[model samples]
Target chain A: MHNRNAWAIAPLMALSLAACSGEADKSADGAPPAPTNQTLAEVIADKGEMDTLEGVIRNAGLSDVLAGKGPYTVFAPADAALGAAGSDLSDEAMKAQGAALLRAHIVPGALTRADILAALERGGTGGVQMRTMADGLLTFSRDGDAVTVTAADGATARLTGDETVAANGVVQPVDGLLVKAE
Target chain B: MKRLIPLTSVLVLALCASSPALAQNGNGNGHGKGHGAGNPVQQDRDDDGDDDRREGRRNGNGRENRAERDVPRNHRSAEVRVREIVGDPPREGERAVRELRRGLERGESVVGREVIGPRRDEVRALLQGCPPGLAKKDNGCLPPGQARKIDRSQSYDRYNYLWRSFGGDGGYQYRDGYLYRTAPDGGLLGYLPVLGGILSTGNVWPTQYTYQQPPQYYSRYYGLNDRYQYRYSDGVLYGVDPKTQAIAQVAALLTGQQIDVGQRMPAGYDVYNIPYDYRDQYVDSADRHYRYSDGYVYQVDPTTRLVQAVIQLLT
Candidate 1:
């Protein structure tokens, strides 16, 4: 599918889900800004260190989706996250692989740390199944205060700190990449 | 009058005896549900047994034999030749073969996915009506525009009989050690016999060439925390200062020699624990590349190495 069309549908799905959950707060236009703080994009932007992810979002042309009124759960990776990736992507490769990689980190619901912890508590042996924007499942396992996120490809990332409260969603810093399953 | 009375009595006695016999037989033909000519219970059991056997055959027992027999000897021989050359093919390399076979069976042109060599039309014609004993040589079977030979002396190490198509889309790739045909769009056609090239001395093709690197200077920061670590692209490492979150590039931190860009790290170090968010972003190289990600800087795995995310490396 064309990248533009894929991204266009993602936001709509997220927005519709948000509306269903009573998460969308309307002002003038049908698309209303989040009631709380900045959007997921703004939260990342506010952090000067996350330039790589911001560049990916910009390069992949997904700035609007992240900035839109979405109840997204973004597992924001740290700058080291990109460096920790074994090799570097070319400009062309960044454009090609960035959106899919970024989408894998963003889930549909604005699930906060507490919400995740609560779900994990109720889930027992089975971890919480958070569906990513790319339509893959991220298994979240909680151990006391720390939360470990397992990607589809079996790579694991730890939630580094407290979840950031964004206007339309929640942002949690992950130590690793949430690689999509092939 | 006495004689008539006796005859009537005899007829009544015969009727009573026949009535009792008919009632015992139920259907009156001496054939009932359990005692019928056709046993429904036994028939059902036989049908179920046949179904089970059919299911078993479908599940690889019987079908496997048939599949082995059905494979064209030439194609099977090509795979055998490949195995002989490679000794044992890796999983990924085997996948390449499977891809080639599927494309050929479906009559699809594999023009773009690295199997570039011949036009789809040419390949279809050759495969559809492949002559018996179509040995590895480029028989004049292909029309003039179908295949044109190219010298692979400089770039390719193994194969000498390299042939590409006229339209610049597809052709045949015959490595001295490897054997396969490519469609016009670079899709794999299928494995072919040792097409007039010396079988490789041994499988020397690099096992680890799968890692793909992400863009340079790309970094994402989660938040300011005590756990944050820092590094310069030049191989320096620093711990994030707790109070200020400031980091400095310390060259002394690198224990071994400085690794050049594109140079794979020599195997010795242990695998650094990689975080998840960056797993999908690494680049793969033929050789190992030095990478610093997660907390510790490390080497990318020789096989399945992605420059973006950490696989396994020397400690």
Candidate 2:
């Protein structure tokens, strides 16, 4: 039976499961090099074209979560692409909606270009289907040398730029925002 | 004296009858050997990794079936073991405790089955001092006439009642809409009225908890492919990709009605096919496949539709 104590114990479980210990980067003792020189949130903020997306993340109250020791991959949207899609980035009341939209582009754990390619090779024609944090699925398939991500509602986006391997994760610049169509 | 049969002759006849029974047992053993040694076709099939141990009784008790004879009288199968637990009140509640054991196969997940094990002895103890007419029901010491009729309304009302206690109000406490044993304890024990008892609560006050709560990132439990970082706090099960670090929630757990493992999820249950893209977490069943229902993934055998391991999603 779930009681008050059981509920209180959940975060402690998370604390235990945070297996990545110490600093993400190398130290004086010469540990393995970090995935990237900076954390994921810092990497996102440093990106010149990801200003709108960065604003959205901040508005969603997720700046700390994404920045904190997260191993999350953000298939972040380009400014021009966000504009082309006509996404409402300025809406004040759509904070929750903004968070949901952001989650559609994100996945848990660190997925690099090599990982995606390996997944494609393993899955073949059916492609690699990844569950999004927003409770939807994104199917990844190869288009020539470029990779494309398709949503459950059939909306598609292509990975446009070199993946920014961050300290905690990767920030992939996509040509289009990975929003699921209604 | 001429009409009466002699005592010595009767004894001899009884001995002759008993010999055939032993021979019958021996013949059953012989048949198993004959199939293994003589039949090349059957031997080849067994070599293909047929579960001979599983089909032992049906295969006429092979040479390895020594437990049936060598076992002590105290050794009982799960069925008999459950039946031996005497909690005959609350009418169907006691029967349900036994049914849990009967429903499970050796290979299947026992997460749901295990829910009843600890309570079996507790119920047995409660029945020891039960009143003549009154029996254990609704986890209380009551008769069939006084048994609490379970319904969604009652379950809700019981959870909301402010007068509830850990050891008061019939030796049971209501928590997270499930019945938990109080300090005193009472009655026949079983799952909730609908099934699967109640949904596991989030890591805070149930009221304060909601799926909308931001996902908690973890480096353990359920994953898609090599991605093992898990997110289960929102009551939705998600796997974090090892490379990208993006978490994907298995969407089916968000909406499907929860059902316990060991019980066959009815055909009507919304069964989501675990996509080929995500690597198998609990198993890679070449002979069978995995399915996602409610909040858990299950390795289900296609031939028997028996749900195997319920993928562990919690700490």
Please provide, for model 1 over A1-182, each residue's C-alpha lDDT reduced to its tens digit, 9 standing for 90 to 100: 69989998998998788776743443234222333567778888777667777777665455655675344568888778866331222132233245446656776444556556655665575686764544356888876667898866676899875466676566778888777222
Q: After superposition, which runs of candidate 2 have C-alpha atoms over 4 Å from their true positions?
A: A1-34, A84-87, A180-182, B1-106, B109-315
Structural similarity to truth (TM-score) of each candidate: 0.32, 0.38
Please, what are the lDDT tens digits per residue for candidate 2 over residues B1-315? 112111122221121122100000000011111221132111111122222111112112233223233433222110110101111221332233233234343422133231101111221122132333445655444446753645533533332222121123444333222333434345434212100122221111121111121112112222223334332322243343435544432321232123333456434211223322222332234444455433234555545665543332332
Considering summed lDDT, which 10 consecutive residues are worst modelled in model 1 chain B? B20-29
Per-prediction DockQ comes to 0.01, 0.02
TM-score of chain A considered alone, across all candidate predictions: 0.74, 0.76
| Native-referenced Cα lDDT, model 1 | 0.37
Q: Write the per-residue lDDT of candidate 1 for residues B1-315, one digit (tens) a residue.
A: 111011122211121121110000000111112211232211111112221221111122222333334433332211100000111221332243343334323433111110011122322232222222333345222223444334432233121222221113345444322334556565555442221121111212111111011111111121112343332111112233334433321111111122221234432221221222222222223443333322223334345331111111111
Q: Identify the candidate with maximal TM-score.
A: 2
